[model samples]
Structure formats: C-alpha cells, structure tokens
Target: MVRISSFGVGGKHKSTKFALYCVGLFGLALLVDLLWASSNSSPSIYQSIVSQENVVFPSFAQIKEEDKKKKDGIDKKRVLADNFADLDAPVLNWEKMANAPVPRLDGAAIQIKDQLFVFAGYGTIDYVHSHVDIYNFTDNTWGGRFDMPKEMAHSHLGMVTDGRYIYIVTGQYGPQCRGPTAQTFTLDTVTKKWRDLPPLPVPRYAPATQLWRGRLHVMGGSRENRHTPGTEHWSIAVKDGKALEKEWRSEIPIPRGGPHRACIVYNDRLYVIGGQEGDFMAKPGSPIFKCSRRNEIVFGDVYMLDDDMKWTSLPPMPKPDSHIEFAWAFVNKNSVVIVGGTTEKHPETKKMTLIGEIFHFEFDTQKWSVIGKLPYRVKTTLVGFWKGWLYFTSGQRDKGPEDPSPRKVLGETWRTKLEL
Candidate 1:
C-alpha cells in the first residue's frame, strides 16, 4: 500500500492549493457580477442581456443609475420655467377703466375692428348661460347681446378671433368639477351664425389659442383627465372669400399634459404659463378618486415657445396657480394676465379670488412683472383685445354641493382699458 501522509506531497500539493485559490477568486468575481446584474435587471436590461450570449459584460447594476436618468421622460429639447429671471421690469402703464360691466368670469370675448365682442359665461351656482355679452368702448355701454346660433357653457377653452371671426375651442361647460366638450365652433361677425369646425383629433379642454400669420393656432389642454398630453397644436385657415378651413398641426410637444390657462401669444411666440393635473372628469355616479377629490394643482413654471418651435424656460409666475379654468390672457401686446384659477381646493369654491394677477412681459425688455388684478371675483376669465380695451367674461364662481350639483357657468362681461 502506498501511504500518502499529511505532509508527504510537497511541491505538487502546494501547486494544487494555489490553483484552488485562483479558482475561488474567479468564482467570487462571477458571483459578484451575477448578483449585480440581477439587482439591475429591468425589462430593458434583460433585453440587453438576452442579446449577449458569451461576452463577459459589465454588471447591469454598475450602469443602472445612469440608465435611469437616460430613461426619464423629461424633455431635453424644451426649455421650461426659470428663463424669465431678467423679466422683472415694471409694465408700461396702460389706461385703466373700471366703469365697465358686472364682475364675472369664464366667458368668451373677441375683437372686431375697434370693438370687443364679449359672450357667454356663468353667473352663480347652477347657472351656465349663453348670453352674447358685448362691450362697446366708444359708446361706453355693456348690455349689447348677439344671438349665438347655439349656446355653449364651457371653461378654459381656447377663445380667439381674427379681425373677422370669433372661435371658441374645447372647454368644460358644466360645474367647476365637470368636463367640457371637445368641439370647435366659430361665429362669423358678418353672418352672426355659429358654424362648427373640424373637431379636434382628440377631446380636450383648457387649451391656448392665438392668431399667428392669419392662422388661428391652438395648443395644450386636458384629454380624458390627463394633462401632460402629447397632442399640442392645431390651427384654422381661411382664404379671402372661401369658407374657413381648419388645419391641425403638431408642434414640439409640451413637457406635460397642459399648457393649461398659462398660454399667450406675443410677438408671434407662444408663452405657456403654469398648468394643472389630476382628474377633472365627472361621470354620473362614479366615485371620485381621492387624489382628484381635492384640488391638485401643479408647477408655477413659465415656458415660452418661439416661432422657430424652440422652447425656453421663463421665470415662474410671482404666484403659482393651476387648474384655473380662466386663468390666462393677454393684457396687452406686451403683457399676459392670469385670472381666476386656484390650486388648493378640488371643487374650487365660490369665494371670489380678486387676486387676478397680471404678468406683463415685454418682448423688447424680455422681463415679467405682476401688474393689476381683474375687477370682479372670477374664475376662467377670458380676455380679448377689442377697441383698445380688455374684455373679461364668463366663468364659475361658487361650484355646486355635489359632483353634479347646481353650479353657475356665467355669461356676464367686464372690460379693462390699459393706460399704455
């Protein structure tokens, strides 16, 4: 019998031990890498792994942090809030006229030649009207009514007017918490008839509309309760005496669901103000989601998209507001005013908020300033420049008791004449 004593196998045993040590180290490295990859294996990571068969790749864990940032949905091309740091200069004082109309909000107004055409708005809880409220600056009168072909009770829809026609886009028509139709309607100043246009590709409300190069441009709004929608642009075109043709185009998508009431067109660039989030739909008997049960407003960041379709972040509004159905308007060619919109309460109250702040940004100065407030306690106030005055019309004040409770969608009117 060959006796193999404990210390008898000299050099050969030493070599075997060294080999074992090296194998153990290799195993440890492999184990560490497997654990790392397992920890970082998302669906994308797995897809990558499945594609690589024999290659010893770096652990997914090692690169996971970097991948998460790259995978984020935030827009790199769009500039957002904070670009308006240089926009704090005082606004050029425009003349102010208070002897206008009754205090109200959430109405549509337009400009025709030298006149401001004010139309439908809600007055109190459960009251959405279709009164075509008109304001004549030359005559200094408030109660002139044009009969609309069909009455619409909506808030936060895009309200725009060419020198010849007035257009009302998608908006919420019922109570403060209700949703509006996704329809487009226009009023011919000459014919005084309401004609429906091609409906939006999707149903939405609270979008921004402005006239650019004779084309009526519309952007932003909520689609099915989601605000950060990808669909962002549409326009209307008319040829001399031909019927109006509606054309829909896509611009660079906004970062999220809305441009909301924070949209204005100045010097051809579109300035989108703060927007809101959460569900605003009112299904007949469905229970409201807890998150949507109360007001859940969003960022105060201001953003501007120039004609070149480039987005630049602007300094935030002095005060943050969201879901303000009527919180955005052009105070003048050089300023933007945001009116009755709130961020704290879901079913926004009828407690009138006169803090209707105006943000005046001069294109020449590239600055912003908070100017005056709207006259009446209001919500979703739409402003149109006509005959050298700003028209405020139609919106909800006090919402009703329950989801479908009686609430007012007003139809009154007011006017603001700037001193600039």
Candidate 2:
C-alpha cells in the first residue's frame, strides 16, 4: 500500500477507487439480504412431528368420582316430570338410538356423506383421545377407529368441516386446560388420512373454531391456564377443494365475551351462545342470573359477529334460561334451539334441580321460550342435525339438588327429527 496524503497516486484516481470500493461493499450487503429473505420465507407455521403421545384415560380420582355417579344403566321407566325439575315443561319427542363405540365428549363432529366423524375429546379424568370414530348412517353402526397423529383434548377442541375436509386446530393435550397444543391438522373425508398444517401463533384451549368462506376462523377460549383473556380471533386462509394455504391473519376480537362451547354461523353471521365466559361465580347475595348458576357462572349472551367482524351482544340466554351449558343449535335462520344442558330452580323446594329442557330462541325478535324437555337430564352432549333428525351422542346426566352425588359421564346416544 502506498500513502496518499502527499498525493502519490493521483488525487482524483484515489477518490474514484474509494468510491468503487464503497459500491462493491454495498453490493455484497445487498446480496446477503436477498439470500436471507429467500431462506426465511416459508409457507406454513408448523412442520411435522412423526411420533406423538397416545391418549390415556382420565386421572384416577376423576374415574372414582365418575364411578360414584354412574348408575347401573338407563332406567326404562324414567319420566321427566317424576324425576327432574320443570313442572310446566312438555316432553320432547326423542328416544335412545345406539351407543357410541368410544366414549368421547367435548370433541368435534362433522357429517361427510354417510359418515359422522367424531374426534379428540377426553375418553377416560379427562384423558385425551387420539382415535377418531366414524359413525356410518347407512349401516347404522360405527366404522374402524381412525387414529390421530397425537392424543389430546377434553371438553374444548376447535373443529369444523367444509363439506370436503375436516380441520382440527388448537386444544389442551391433557385434561384440565393445562396443556394447550398449537398444531393444526386436517383429514380428507374421502381418503380418511391425516395431514399437518401450520401451527398457531400461540397455543390455546377451548377456542371456538369453524370454517367460513374457505378459511378457518378460530376465536376465544383460555389463552393462559384456565383464565380466559377476553375475545381474541384469528383466521387461516384455506383454498377451495380441501386446500389450506400458508396465510393466517388476526381478526377483530369480540367486543365483550368469548365462546364457551361452540360458535354457530347463520346467514353469514357468527353467533356465540350459551358459552362459559367468565371464571367467577355469582356474588353470595346476588341473585343467580339465567343460564348462570350461583357458583358456575355461565352466560347465555347471544353475541353476534357480523360480516364486518363486529360483535353485537344480543339477548342474554333466557332469564331463567337455566341451561348454562353449551349444547345449543339453530333450527334455521329464524329460530334457535338449545337442548340437553339445562337446569331449573324451584322456589317452593328452595333448591336447584337438574333437568333436560329444550329451549328456543328467535334471531329476529331476540326472544326465548321453553319448547320441550329431554327425557333424561343430560349435559355437555354432542348434537348434529342431519337429514330430518337431530342426533345427540354421549353425554352425562347427574342427580339434581335432590341428590348431591357426583354426575355421570355417559355414552348414551339418541336422535329426534325436528318438525319445525
């Protein structure tokens, strides 16, 4: 190297050389930037895991608690008026059908052609299940067990179908809302095989999930342990013909409450009804509200999420709605139906009694009424409407205040055709 202070090399030449050197350095930096961007860009948030844990039965304590509640079998002479609450309720026209091959609840179900695929949920304290059972309507029986990639869920797992493929999103791996998993999976209804998609930005349990306009919309549920952090919504873009793209985006969280059991979409609008919103129970002296019990504070808040993704809190569950659980559905665009999960209070007896009451809500008028009563007092059951019948599967019935014994988790399945 030669000193340039004395202008040994021509002054102008030195300046030009320095300028060229700077340009070369800039080009090198640009090349590295392009390479990094290319390498980091990916289509999905998740990769794949080969081996996952198998779902075991619930904890021993829960099993013992359930055993205390279990009855020998269904009692044939069971009558609603004689055994349960709701003195003025009319009997609902439904009967026992067939028992589920596997006992599962709080899972997801989708009817594809003749097969009703029910997956995840707790099996034995809240033992997460890895197997998916397919109920064939044609044969009136269940098909072979479809094993999932992993074992997880109890109570809340996000599931929905596009009449093509079934999508299962986040949920707690173990029961008790502790192990929230982030991965998303899909099954081709025709092929009956499982495939992994992108992972959730954050793991969550009990978040409500549904398929809308070729995209998977997941919202609400517990972000932390059992504490719900208000209304948060996220969506992943899925293409037509059972294809999921690599795009996921955040949606406007609901203004107030979140979904408890499930969210129903009607007339391009989303409705959250009869969901467990808050963790706190009613105050000691505060009168228990409708759908909400003294300690088990539930909400019948009819929150509607419009096309603009805005939420409208409509009529809360019927005052004395009493059905603080999540087994609710819409008969059509005009009317809503709530079944199974219900309870009633008797002022004369001064006690809360468990009852299987069928309730109705009107969307246009925002009104609620007692339509009928389920034969057996049941709660947390799965309801699916197909053909002309509303099919209910696998739920527990508890002895009301009349009996303080632990409630039962049952595998009883039944169906009733809705005339309305």
Best by TM-score: 2
Instruction: Report the C-alpha lDDT of model 2 over 190-289, residue by residue, as the tens digit.
Output: 7777777787777775677776765788877766444454467888887533445575788988655433445667777777666554432223343331
Instruction: Provide the lDDT at 52 for model 2.
Output: 61
lDDT of each: 0.56, 0.61
Top lDDT prediction, candidate number = 2
What are the candidates' C-alpha RMSDs?
14.6, 28.8
Backbone clash pairs for candidate 2 read: 58-124, 58-125, 59-125, 300-317
- How do the residues 1-420 of candidate 1 rate in per-residue lDDT, one tens digit apiece? 978876767868898999999999999898777656654744344445554456355465646654664589533223222221112333333443443354344555665654666655544434444657566656656656666545354445677666577777776655444655767777777667777776666666667666666666677676756333434676666432223665566657765556355556677776667766544445446453211342345556767777677778877756555544344555466665555454333223422222344555566676656656544334455555554565655555343322212244454556656654
State how far residue 319 of model 1 sits from its true place (Å): 1.7
Show where candidate 1 strays beyond 4 Å.
1-105, 151-153, 173-179, 226-231, 239-247, 283-292, 322-333, 336-354, 373-377, 382-420
TM-score per candidate, in order?
0.60, 0.67
Clashing residue pairs in all predictions, respectively, total 49, 4
Q: Can you tell me which runs of candidate 2 are displaced by over 4 Å?
A: 1-87, 151-155, 240-247, 278-296, 319-333, 342-355, 400-406
